[model samples]
Target: MANEHYAKFIEEAFVKPIRSVLIIDDDYPTLDEMLELEIIHKNGDLPPKSDKRWHDNPGRIKSVIDGFRQPQRPLLVDIHDGANVDTKGDAKVAAHLHQSDLLVLDYELDKNRPQDGARSIEILRGLITNDHFNLVVIHTSEDLDMVYREVILGLLGATSDELTEGEQEAVNQLIVEYEDVDENALQALRAAVATDQYLHARLHASTYMRTMGQGQQPYSDFCALADEAGWDNGNRRLVLRKLLADAERPLRARMRNASTAGLKWATSGVRWVKAESVFIAFSSKADHDDLFADLQNALEAWNPAPSRLFMAKLRAEMDEYGVVAQTEALERQHALAHWYARLLRSKGDERRWLIAESVLRHSDQLLNTILRRVEVFATELISSEAVAAGDNIEARCQEHFNVDLSKAAPKKKAEREHNAFVSSKSPQGWHLTTGHVFTMNSEHWICLSPACDLVPGQGATRNADFGDRTPFMAVKLHPVPVDGNHDVNSNLYIFVTLDGEVQKFCFNSQGKEAVSPVWRTLYAERRGLLDKDFGFKISAMGAGSRKLVATIHPAQVVAQLRYEYALNLLQKLGVSMTRIGLDFV
Candidate 1:
């Protein structure tokens, strides 16, 4: 019953107008279908022919060809010679041009000369001067030279086979370049599994794509494939057996017992074409400016805070990881920015509040500066410039709030001793050596070894006597502060590893000594930066050095004096106790 109903509906829906089509394809079935469609739409009557009115009538042609839409202005241009054509042939060609809407012309004419097609095309060019919209298809069976092939065929043809041998070989070589991409993916997956850092797989994917000039193809594909594969079989089960086989015993065992069901998505004809394109576009950027602009626009248009926040996160990511090749990045960034600006114009000021919140939240200096620049313009009416400046604020706020302690002085010896250890001697003997004296918090008490001691008697000792064996004559260094205390104890320890060497350290504690060794070949210098608000300079004692000094800024102390102003504002806003906490989070 349903089948009969559907058949009736299809017949009733698709069988009216039948005659208007100028069926050029030499194929009959398509013509029949067109006629059937015409009949369906025209109430069983055919369209009038020779009236020139059907040429203006609007209708869509369903065919493999896409560039052609209207039959009135056919784009296929034939450059056939007029000399070979008699008046009858000329009339037919003219009829095709005037009635059929398109004239597929032969480029060469045999009656004139060997170069008739090219000459014919040139001569007919006068006929379609204003009709540049008409497509001039230069079709030929002859095998032209490479340059001619490229100019005459390759650019015009939609298929790869249209390219010459050299071009095809070049394309094949390009394909070969990506042949090992799957292997690289496997290796990255294996490494990620070993490290238990699944996110690192993304990095590996990105790196591999960049290396092969494929941008993000391999990485995006891996992610999309993995996502499609699902987690039903456990992530470990989803890993390749070959990769796991070389892994340690436990991982190998996991692979052996893995479920094949998790791989259903992998076999579901999954293609990463779109994802690869996106990756390539993103990774090939010349600079982040345009991306930043787009993000700003999106953020301004985003609502509910979370969306804007998400955009901000994306902006941060792009700024950090976007390809640094300035030309590409800049071009992409500008184009993206322009598009985003248009999008924001469509969305209006609701996104502004979100942008403001995001900017204020970051507390960065550069971002704040940019924000301040646009503050005047951000009030009632917003413009693209304001959005841009606001975005810059969000980008730079972290830097704005950063404290610089590079020039600050070290803690006084008396202060360090008070903070780190309760030890003190009376009169002249109670002196602390000046070697980057500062308070650092540690869970364990620090034992000071006598590299060279001044009037040392015994040394320092831990008062807790909990697992501490190092003997001290006067007092032990309390590295961690007690509860409710503002003082910080010195708990700083530096470890150095040299290339191609193993480091061994021996420590004695409580009548027992232990030795530990670590690989030093991977050692590289890592440094920390002080915030812009931090106000201290750090200097450490080197070998044979007796003293180290740090300078402090008195102005910082004065600035902290005003910290209460902000705190009071928070308290008045009812946010101090409820929302504000000492923890960094």
Candidate 2:
């Protein structure tokens, strides 16, 4: 009775459009009386008598049955007495059995009628075979073994090998009745019988029962059954066969609807750029080895076209963002293109050489162009200032550079009070007394004597003499970390060349006060330099080293001026210094 309640619950929850329920039992009057009472209790009407045998308190039972009856879900009920089995009356029951959507039977229909259960089984089995019934339940109080042997096994055709005379008679009766059935229905019944055999071999009884009890649609149910059965066996041929069966063939629209619904459910909230379809067809094959491989190849070959389309769209987006013409973006594109080009033109080791050479050449040219611009800018700034200031530059020159040029011309060597003046013989043996005096613009002072060793290349040896001279006066450029305060060596100085090239150097503080402090150039280039190496040995220099001085030799000043003037002209022509990597500051 509990199983019957659960079965009714399952039917109410999952099944739909149940047209009628047919009951086949030995005691027809008692079954009919109980159904009437159940309906009356469902309508909230109590029985006139309080006999417990007629009706239990209805309570939850009324609610369950009323719920099943709402909106008249099941329209009709039919009952047939099993006492009329194997007679013309049985034929009348069979004639209308296909009209019912559900079938409820008594397992032991009658003690006198030995074939009553078999007759019930035959009728239900035929309807199930033709796919006319949605559900079937044997509601008898008989033993479970009797039900399994006489009803379940007989319906499943499991005991056909050892059928009794009565069972044989029931089977013959079904054949005779099939003659009156429609051709299409008979064909479907035969196909269903074959499918039942296949299902029984693969699925357990519990799996079949549960699936049938809860299934929504016949085709979908068959698919679910096949999936459960084949899931553990690692064989899907039977599943595919069931899905592709002619009797249960899925409509094209249904397939597309199911697929679309599934996709929507699976990909909810996901964003996609495009959706399209591709079709691949193959002839049926007995061996599936080639089937999977062929499908894979087809899919792989089809992928590149769509992939290329997506990449093109991505490239278009990058172009809109100005990324393609940007520095790193251009470099990456060039590198990939150049690598592939080289690989195509050369073989093996030669390809590597070609790629490396192309990359190095591109890098060198880029660096050189950047450096040239910076050098030119710095040089022009210094030279233009020097020429425009004239003699008024002496004050600025004294402020920036330590050189002072305020004193009058010296008289005799003996009258000179400062030791800064030198009296010496030139390498050519000419005697000369050299005085350091300001140049015409007063920016820098030079040796007055033409034969002085202070002339370019003839000066006394100093640490600064080891490097080239720039006309720009050197000032203490404060050192600050470009990125953050975490730099290990923040005390740095940068000297800008007259042509705008900047050199970074740090003061070496290792020695005692016995010697003048020396500044070592850590990084030097025409453009700009960023040093990463620290805590390493470097050359030392004195404060008076010419390398520390920014003033160029007088002989080189004219050349430096001419170079800057040309750069200024280029700037007027709309050339951007910063674009070429020059930092004016």
Candidate 3:
């Protein structure tokens, strides 16, 4: 019955309003399909086929889907193995996820070849990371408490093992459904957690989101809380206890009210969809007065035709597109205009397909560029007096949004900037590829060996004649002091760029003398280094001394450094192959 709670709430809030939904399960909900399609999992990870509840799970979902009325029925997509998600991958799954108003996922996706419902979190996480707003509901006959706990921790970037003893205790205590706290509830929680035997109970997704999540902040503030707790016996447990306790304070009645509010909110999307329908209806059903009224409305909408306005927008909003991109875009506009004209003439499904096709044809960099511009614009805009009058950004926001953004404790500004250039990987990272960063004897270094020299099968042949079977060419990474007042924006720095001016750097300088004062100083020093110590300095690392700290992001090398700068760096290293420095220098 608890597992079936999903059908009742969904039928009431989702089905009636005709809200689009994406359902993910492992079965097609029929005896014939189940008999033919059910593949035995090697581990025997699920209940036996004889179990009525397990066998009839898909039938339950199908019943609710059947309840949905026709004549503008809600868009419903059912995904299972050999269905929407298959060997080709879940691109269609991602599209439906983005378009759907709600997501209904089975907690046990291990019913087929690709095991574990948790794996679906990877797709959901990717979408959320890109700032896609979404809600999710999980339905299963598994222990409800454990399922809820896993979903919360999984989405918020943590796992049960990462939790301290105290956090685990607090979580267990919170899951016990009781109108008021008592020794019995506390004992039940402890027993359930210890034995890993949890009982079924009702659950709600929105309640969890609003309760644990910090709204726009990623996750459920679980990451932030863990950071604050320091994962020690002290704070993590206390904060988690408070967060969970607060979540339980709201009753099931309040949950229903929130669901009601959401149903009201669904009307906005309905109106957006209905906007185009008005014209279609007008063409078919219009009498004399109706045609005249629509004509007046149509004229009003064309105050500055949307097409013309967007065309002039690139000129008016020059800062949004960097000068380089703006100059480059002029050549592409003529072709785009012709395509847009054809798109406008097309109707129905063809137009929608063309829109998707046109968007895909453009480079990802162009979309990413737009996003970067918007971030830059918003960051500046939010800090201004118009958004919030006071100077305290956090305090002002607490007043503005009623939720604190700082609670998420995301990667720091400086660290994120540095990471953009050098993608770091731990000792447990993938294969020892070229460009992997290393530190030995307190000095940073990079692998100068070709990728073939480190890859297992190819590397053996490449280094077969060397002193050590796994010998690698090495290059030193000269450090620029950026610890204190030293400007990270300086051209001397290879990684961290505080002001994002690093992108414009033409190998050494953006020049036009538009650079910061720090760059001017670094520029002269770099010039002097070339003049005095221009010779390439390479070293060899024998088999024993190859400990690595992190690996560099090659995409940065491909996108940003695959230029004359790379050629210059390569040429210097090439010319001095005859001479080299000491091991791990």
Candidate 4:
């Protein structure tokens, strides 16, 4: 009744070891079967640790997480299932989606009531753009030939195949149990996965990191793939670094095994690897100098440059490779000590401080290095403020780390040299703001260069005054017939607000208005009768004394005014505000 055989495979292959899984399908039967299996097997009792799957073999789990290094996971959500997904259920679905590394969505629903496909995609797209992590997988069970000919090749851009014997059984069970299947469901699922960019990004990242162990070249290849895919963001880069670091975590465990076997592996000869119960291996104990050299060489070759951390790691490898050379070993020991000292003196997270302290406890000669690093941090605290606050170096120093310059001994002539060094290293004119800020409402804008006049609408009033009649009114303007290519001044937009709440607001660099091109495009594409759209509305005030509440139309000045204000705020914050445009329907 439980497909008793699957119970063993499920338990051994998934449930017992893997605590979490993403189940995806449009068929209620398939979903029921999975859920039943989970319930019957008590698999749901597994810990919901999204961060790691410890039940998996350490090596395997590492591979999986490494594969998922890209920010997002594939999420399988059955939006058509009014039971699991509905307008009201979207929030719940989204919450669940946020917890997963990937997304799986069922395109079809059993009701034949037809959920809006575009709307579903819109919701997912919105979340994907906002999150920038998570992979997506779409599942479908249409006829192989038809699917191959139509949806896969034409609509979804996926390759199709006949179901395998086991898959056939699953699909049969699904169809028999849930007789109501819609044709568009699978298409919707395929389109959702194929067209969305988040899925593409996640999949590429996961696949690349997953292949890190095959060789150094594969890891390099992955980095190239990332650059090509436009996933060159900070988090994506962090994944590459983490993958390398994690490669070190398990070396201790492996070394113990190698050491016990009397293997000549460099990892084992040194105490770099650890045993389950004890530190059986020592970094100095490893005897396989040749293996260590080769391994370190390979690792260095694989790691890209321009990273200070990577350089340090490379140096560590070189030291390991030259462990037999006493002179080189001494140099390396000193370098490592110096490195630890630098870490100790840095600012930011206290964990680095602790790590440095631990390293220092092992080597006292590192004291000088530590002191130097502290001076570097202190100098930074001073110099950065100096640049940002305009030569008030003391005030700058006080602002950054809350150091009291008033209490410190006056600077000596030599201190000027250190200041010069600090200035050289400090990023050009970039300074962290001290709490004390001086704001002045000058008649002239900050950029007083001759080209300042070229800055769009430089002196335009911040308020959107839509006549005096609508006092205390506010307005939000969006593109009219909102589905089209957006030209800020060309496309008309509707504004909504109380009609007269005026405030000075800033506009983004585009200077056209606050509306974004993408928003306008979507709005224009979906423009139709107001009553037909879920988000569109226009109404007059209620009760005996009636007045217009808000109107939807092109050329809405209120929307532009509000948008301008928001844009100004974003500019002040130094965040790019041009990503998404405004569109009104």
lDDT of 4 by residue, 51-125 (tens): 212234346323333433323433232322324554323665566555543343433333344432332333333
**CA lDDT, every model vs. true structure:** 0.27, 0.35, 0.37, 0.30
Candidates 1 and 2 compared: the better one by TM-score is: 2
Over all chains combined, what TM-score does candidate 2 have?
0.22
lDDT of 2 by residue, 36-80 (tens): 878999999995553221144345323323433567463466666
TM-score for each of the candidates: 0.16, 0.22, 0.29, 0.20
Report how far off residue 585 is in candidate 4 (Å). 75
Give the alpha carbon lDDT tens digit for every residue of 488-532 in model 1: 221121111212221111111211112111101110001111234
Best by lDDT: 3
> RMSD (Cα, Å) of candidate 3?
19.3
Estimate the TM-score for candidate 3.
Answer: 0.29
RMSD of each: 27.2, 39.6, 19.3, 27.7
lDDT of 1: 0.27
Ten residues in a row with the worst lDDT in model 3? 519-528
lDDT winner, 1 or 4: 4
Error of 4 at 97 (Å): 0.6
| Candidate 1 runs further than 4 Å off | 1-241, 244-369, 374-585
